[model samples]
Target: MNKIISAHPVGAGLKIFQNDPEIKIHDDVLYIPRIPGPHDSNYGIYDSYGRLVQTAGPRRGWPNFSLGQSQSSSISPSSSYPRATENSYFYGGHIGTHFGHFLTETLPRFWCAPHWYLNKKIICHSGDTIEKLFSVSWIKEIFEMIGLVKEQFIIFDRPTTVISLLIPGASFEENHFSHRQFAEFCNKLGRKYAIDLGISDPIFLSREKFKSAMRTIEGEEEITSILRNKGFRIVYPETLSIREQMGLFCSDRLTSGFVGSAFHNSIFCSSPRGLALCYGNSYSTNFWLMDQVNDANIQYFSTPTLLLKNSPRVGVPAEFTVDNPMDVANLVIDYYEEKSVLKKENEKINYGKKEGPYLIKTKFNSFLQIDRQLGKIHAGSGVGPRIHKIFAYVFDSQWIELFTLGGDVLSMDQLDSVSDTLNFKMQISQNEKTFSLKHPVTSRFVSTTPDGVVECNREYARAWEQFLLISANQN
Candidate 1:
């Protein structure tokens, strides 16, 4: 890892746009189309001055890591590209796919859409057709909530030159805190369109449905069970419509959940209120900005655990188990409940487990064999249909315990070392057949090096870093 001697978070020092509707108008602009592939071309609008309009696209990793700043991928349009005689206002590009990003990044500039640019056509590089662009029901509802009709959108796929383009500066920085203007816009819009559901019970936003192979929290069910017994209602945000979510989150009730886009729904709350967040591994600085803008009484209960696999991004954690779900649930229970009404169910909560004597192999089809004498793991035996060594695994809460068929434990320390217990997290690949083991205590993956040496020291799980688990039959 390349260490920075003097590292600083870029967010605290960012220069945000003023809290007002500021539109930058450019005449005779060229719009470039992106050709999707291994190396997709950057798509954006370029002005007559030969400068890519910064407001036309989203900038990721801003004010965070040094490499976070996204450069303008806007290239010159070819002469053969079609020209649009009409003018349109810029909306956003590829960032619209995600709900959080759509709310924070794509629609932030649209704070001026209702009054200033209500009649102007909005142009974006999101999809080919308006139906495809607004394919998501809630997203379409949100656009309609802001008075933007389907006819008002101009979805451009191929290269097209425009006579005029109006670019509204984002009221908030991409990865930093949002401005008061943007916050107030969401507040007013949410309240205006919010249906009166009269939701009273405290809600726990569950990420169960949205859980992906890359970022799964293993012990979330146990935590949810404990919270449920304490009177916290478990809610899956994906199951609710945009209006229902707005109404639910806006109600005068305590909201708790793992830090994610669901928590971002708090932006629609009538005002800032109490939020109990279950956090593990790393967190985004954007939460701080959210709290700052919303004035939320945010309480973070850290459920620390090392990520099992590596995330695609630098700061994102791949997979982790909540160290102590009961501790976090207790904190939320104490903070929310005035009196404990249910105790019988809490005692019956059982954590899930997976135990197997399985064979572990590398992507190159090499079996992983442990050398107990040296306390080292290595890739051994070439591909063939024959008998070989096998391993067994047990789940300890969300932690995975790797053991030899002979009952030797896999430890970061030597086999017989009396150090802290080594905890491993198993991450299943997208294909589901392959898996990668991560050493949470040391934040390393059980990876095979270039020379075919197995070590729990890989930072990322690339092609050679992946492992496949095969179920072995016991005699």
Candidate 2:
């Protein structure tokens, strides 16, 4: 086996982004291990001391060999192929299908892998080209979005060199902390990738109906028609390209249907407040999905997984039911149904509903500024950059600002109230999927520059001007 020395994690406080991590450089080359074909759900990395690469920061003395990170493996590139040329370029590509597997079972490894160096080559360990097993375009699109460039990917056609190769576990246990961290990271990736790829902005459906898979959801036909009548679009994720799937997921305010890999779309899409994974009794099968959804700060609730006698077992236990689907549908609708009323001005607007003093964050991961301005254009410019809570609520037919980051609505005549200027409301409107935050009492949207610094008084219509309204306590 080829030996790697001075190999350690990139360091602490790194953000998880993609499926392939740049953990350490071996022989002056960075290695991105391949996910074994059969076991696609879990994987990890360990140093020669058998120490699993750690999430603890450098201050914690991470990559501590004393921790015992070693795990057993059966595959060794050294045994199968000739050693890699001492100074030749080597790349690893990763591949997988099955949305559930890809999201929970597959992605977390790459998410937390070291990324201290961005200039190195990143090879995908896909057994075949990513396109062969799944939608090739979609795979490439996701990889690039996560920071992998087309120039960095390479295919190993012949046994030129290799020695020992990294192995990502397929059936390994997923780390709860990492999964949650990655879930939020994946949500950001989904939005950024969709916008970058020009995936059309989504139309928010109160209940997007999707029931195409063969999993026998009892009374599915009736359920489908009922949801359709209730304004849910009959979406089939499998039929749509990855781009289209992302657009629909990112745009939709709420999406629902029988739980399965199809809903894996939610991993990357954060627009929805609640994703109702319909189930009947199989509470155990849904936790992985629940953990993922929760990590993204999106609400997930289960109704029932309906199935009949003699129904083939497909993981989740089935609960027999004959009640009208509308009753079950109420579980989601009651929570998500957007309330509206025609106004005297000939416009439909939010009427009587729970007005959220919700917090706002940019689709790109910046915390919204409440200062009516910002301190630094870039959040990562220094240590402990201030992240404040910026809140909003519906006003004048748009979601207007109730408070900005670091400041709140002035309740008393105290100095705080004077600084906030609560009387002059800031106009906020959503353009497509992005929210445009406007100046207090002006038409200008609260916007920022390419580097994230607040641009003074700019007309906000595009992405840099947009923000997502996450409920209070969501981060």
Candidate 3:
């Protein structure tokens, strides 16, 4: 096998390839190695002291080492590629910078599904790390062909983090300590990744420690009050139902923690803009599955040191100190502003009226007249100078009876008077399949039926009138 420098090392021992017979090293060019047995396919690089640096390939065969340049591969150059423009087309926070490399190489092939594309494009929630990452630059590249910025924009704020507690086990202390460490790691990650705010479950306290900490935080106030005043929201893992916890996570703008199965369950129902921050030192099956699901943005944070040991802790308890939440909050604000500006410019280019004549067909027997000053609908006869109200209501329960009654009903000059009193406009075609109405308070109400008349409830009529009033006020 070709020998390469190891990126990670343990102690003084250098790790090396085993059972690879077809590998060759020529002029510093390392050739692909052929592995023999189930374990033979594994390859590794070691330091001078036999410490392992990096490992690749499976145990049974050679791994594909192509750098995503194969023409036959799904990630070919001709794929729907993002624009190469720098700040205008691509923008991200700290974690974004770290994870950006993977998107460039994998997204074209992996994001082939139309649903994933749609979910990525039309975001319903904003004001979070994921929203900021998407709105600032990536969204522009995807929707540049269509003016996306000109539409109305609404942002929702999430202000809490929920944590799930693990069951007690043999290694409970180790798990608890590891969780604390993970919290600290995430704290650092937030700072580096420019995440402005974070909330996490406080570390479970030992009997002695819990009482001590409680006393210290509260000199005169009750323990709960002091914690609340200090901007802490205490949550018990068992207190919340699964659905409630999922709701919290789904609503959170950004969340970071271990790769717990609970997080997976929560994210399955989360909004598209939700972000799941996973610790690097975990099994990550749920995280991998989440990537497969492609619902929300999943970010994995790992340090070079964590790579040396294949066995990293999972579901550990730890205390994490968040430095500043305002920074992230401000960045989100700026991203939204940029998105708004870009959206407006795009709409101006795409919105225009059609320049051709069009015909409208309907099946109703009644007709309508249009109001010039106020847009509304009214019931009336076909021959009229002013607006008319076209009323179609059924008193009979049976369809035939209703039709007979409607046909035999007397035509009222009072109908014309009622129409005039209401300042209604209406029109009906000779075909008797369609009608329109314009009322004083309500705008035009159009309907079509084979019999030319349609039924309306009292509530609908009243609502229509109210709608017209609102429209008039706006005008």
Q: How many clashes in each candidate?
A: 0, 29, 58
Q: Estimate each model's TM-score.
A: 0.62, 0.45, 0.19
Q: Is 1 or 2 the stronger prediction by TM-score?
A: 1
Q: lDDT tens digits, residues 218-266, model 1?
A: 7778889988887778888888878877765676688777777766777
Considering lDDT, which of the candidate structures 1 and 2 is the better prediction for this target?
1
TM-score of 1: 0.62
lDDT of 2 by residue, 1-475 (tens): 1111111111212222224333433332222243445443223332333333343110112112212222422232233443444343323323455555555544554554435214444334454554464455665666666666566655444422333333332211222223344556666677665542232322222223443333444555566666666665666666666656655556435555545565556556654433444443222223333343334333334343333655546555443453456655554454455432212221223444436777656656765443323322221112243444445666554535355556543221111112342322234453445566543322344465555565324434566766666777654
- Indicate the worst ten consecutive residues by lDDT in candidate 1: 1-10
lDDT of 3 by residue, 208-241 (tens): 1232211111111232233344444433323444
lDDT comparing candidate 3 with the true structure: 0.25
Give Cα distance to truth, residue 358, candidate 2, Å: 44
Compared with the true structure, model 2 gives a TM-score of 0.45
lDDT (CA) for every model shown?
Answer: 0.60, 0.42, 0.25
Best by lDDT: 1
Better of 1 and 3 by TM-score: 1
- Span of ten consecutive residues with least summed lDDT in model 2: 1-10
RMSD of 3: 28.4
